[model samples]
Target: MPLSDIVRALNAPATGKRPDFLYRSGLDHPFVAAEGRVFIHYANIRLESKFLPVVDTRSGRTHGHASTIQAFGLSNSVPMSPDAVFVLPTDAEEFVYLDRLVRTLHALNYLTQPVRGNLLLRVHSRHIISVPANHGLAFEEILRPCGLLPEQITLEINTDAVADKEHFIRAVASYRSRGYGIAISHFGRTELDFPFLSQLRPDIVKLDNLLLASGRPLDRIIDNIHELGGRILIEGIDSANLRRNASSLAIDLVQAHAPILRPSGIRIRRNADGGEQLDAAA
Candidate 1:
């Protein structure tokens, strides 16, 4: 669909109240990409003040008019839009957090997409129990109407959480049954049993940036993973060198934060003179 059509669809009237857990006060400027994606980030804060008197132990002098001020900030920030949204799960407060995330995205006119792409959500294994047994079913009901396929959305499970084989297997099974893609993140850092991972057969495996940065022999690992029928995604690529190296290794996907910030929309081409040309799109 055209971008204008998507914008119009997003602006249409909503039928119900917004989710209660949504941090409406801290909603940031919505960033819309040419691909029709939207992103929003927010922060939550709590402040407290207490009055107290202080005394100097060495000088034996008492002082008054002293006060203590403390501010605790807990951010539940995420990028939301029709094409894609990224969420991080830090606490076991699954229902409230997920409810707010889904409702916020739904309200932002993203749910109107006939075929939304990936909705990447980062979740820990410990909090998996907080998710309902039939959570995948609920997600299917919520996202399928928006034209999102189970494979299009991925739940990024942190490696730390996957140490428990039972929980990991169960969660993987549940999501896979509903057709959602399961990706194991922080691949190299974790001491995971490769044979066990082969058994689980995850759809995607994200290699840690540190391994790539170290200039290690990643090609062998990538080839092995591909042979096992899993696609490899290299994350935390920051420089052109890293991208070049990743491409050399035949990595399937390379994701970086910096490149998106200053998007030139430039398509590189090889000129007839055997030189590279940058063609900036309008």
Candidate 2:
């Protein structure tokens, strides 16, 4: 759809009370989100790139719920728009729309700090603007206009969804050249590991604690990342024991209800045990 059309669709007047989390960005994309200086903090753990939000998915795993307006904006009825919007590199125009979206978010950063530690806030590579071989100067256009320094952002690649290797590698390098942090996440228990890490050299590799095992090659992987000057994140940690084992293997960071939420009585420390709440420092 044309950008003007999307904006017009969103700009149309509402019929009822709008949901607090609902945002009509005057774009075709309708998103449900919190307003005003909201940030999701990622614990630096062993490493320090602190600002990373998936789709701006946000800080420290502190998830919340927001309902869409019953009668306003995009839809005249229920279900609102879909909860998520996926962009494809089908055409240059897609990137054109995305470019505007990201730049607007970058401008919003001026009203709020986008950094937490040494890391940058995570964003996606849709519209080919984030993909190097396909970017076609999109990269050049984004950072400069967004007024974002390389240090405050991390571009994310869904590990399970990668379709092209050569082009993706080039994409990683392209962003890396400009100082963007790269993180590969949503890694699962399967053995379909990324063999190109040695070549791509992502800043962080995330794995699920559910996939932790007696003979998994996690140690070897950790060693490889350490050699490359990168770090590992263990997600899906639900227990103290799981966190304990992850810490034993030297997992750099984690995301789970227990770790993210400050346990009332636990002494938060970065030690042999699973450390304190990450947001504690922030």
Candidate 3:
């Protein structure tokens, strides 16, 4: 189906009120089509999706694309860091609504093309904590209308700040049970974290670029992750040397800063309106 038609279909009013847990009061379809791409409008905020390629070192091919959103203030057109949106003083329900909205926006924009590889999505830790049960159920429902399967998505969660390890483990298990892949973002550097990681058994372990720069030996950590059947992804890779190190270290996935700035095959129409400024480059 055409993207315009899909937008129309998605925006059409439902026969009954949507569940309050899914959206705030008076919120409807927030999606807009621009230059063949999708942007979302919500409460004086505008969001656009960017897909960063996660390259496979061995084949030198993109193994998957990680979905990231760039946010801007709708009133002043000033850019806001992606993390700023989550810091608002919103209730749990509203936060869940906002978090799921962003993920849905990414999913819709990505599914518009017949692309290879799974979609890597970063889930706010607060969003995980807000839900009392059934972690992936709501997001899975959101993906259903877009023809996206839970197996096609990997949820990246930053686990370092999680105060409740038990809750975190259960949440990861719930997501996995629903066919979603799990990735522990910015994973710890020490061997102590490895036992819990082994217990959790995530599909991917993402290391911060700073960890590699620290000159600490990651050999044991890498071996432990591999032994537990998890792949390693190094995030925020910025230089040629870092890329070379990633290959030499047997890293399975790498996310670079430069390639993320380039367009990943989606074209925005030149005629975007509604005070939403968008780049027309593809």
Best lDDT among the predictions, by candidate number? 3
Q: Work out how many backbone clashes candidate 2 has.
A: 11
Off by over 4 Å in 3: 13-22, 189-192, 258-282
TM-score of 1: 0.55
Instruction: State TM-scores per candidate.
Output: 0.55, 0.53, 0.86
Residues 21-93, candidate 2, lDDT per residue (tens digit)?
Answer: 1232433233222444212111111111122222111233422111111111222211111112223324655
> Which candidate order results from sorting by TM-score in descending order?
3, 1, 2
lDDT, candidates in the order shown = 0.48, 0.43, 0.76
Q: Given candidate 2, what's the lDDT at residue 64?
A: 15
Clashing pairs in 1: 10-109
Model 3, position 76: C-alpha lDDT score: 68
lDDT order, best first, reads: 3, 1, 2
**lDDT (tens digit, per residue) of candidate 1 on 1-282:** 444444334333242222223323333222232334433232342222222222222332332112122223334222122112213344556434544343334323334444334445545454465664654665564443345566656666765435566666776788888887777777777454577677667767778766656667777888878887877775543445645555566666644321111134454544323355566532
